[model samples]
Target: MVQTTATRLKNRLRRTDGQLQGILKMVDEGRDCQDILTQLAAVRSSVERIMGVVVAENVKRCITDDQLDTDQQAQLEAALELVVKNH
Candidate 1:
């Protein structure tokens, strides 16, 4: 993975982790349902963004990596399929 992508993913993951902890605390403290749901939505969005980055990085590698041979095109296709199917 590219350094910038890795850093972005890590930062987003950390934010989501904090959001998850906050959600747990809210549940334990009996906070408002709407507030908790909002936070949870934020976490979901963060996770989706990270997933996008992962797929993008893989796609970039598939396009630019000189290490892959002609025979490895199938492998690249499979990887792309995984990313697309998941989405």
Candidate 2:
């Protein structure tokens, strides 16, 4: 079995996705508002962490290849900005 970083990230994201679906079902089932809100907040935090991992991975790849162009760097910054803004 070949274990890759991308595979790990993908697996983590899939688990998070399942958690999100369960949260949605809880909301639909009329669970307590406070509880649902807490779960939603957790989901947001998980997503942010995932995004950070992805960004770090990309930066690592770029650094390894010595190909971190200005445009790519700017795009990465913009993505970070969007994630922070939405959060």
Give lDDT per model, in order: 0.79, 0.77
RMSD vs true structure, all candidates: 5.8, 6.2
User: Candidate 1 overall Cα lDDT vs. reference?
Assistant: 0.79
By how many angstroms RMSD does model 1 differ from the true structure? 5.8
Candidate 2 Cα lDDT to native:
0.77
Tens-place lDDT digits, model 2, residues 3-43? 69789788878988988898889988999998988888887
Candidate 1 residue pairs in backbone clash: none
TM-score of candidate 2 against the unseen true structure: 0.66
In candidate 1, stretches whose alpha carbon ends up further than 4 angstroms from where it belongs are 1-3, 65-87
Candidate with best lDDT: 1
How many residue pairs clash (N, CA or C atoms closer than 3 angstroms) in each of the candidate models, in the order given? 0, 0
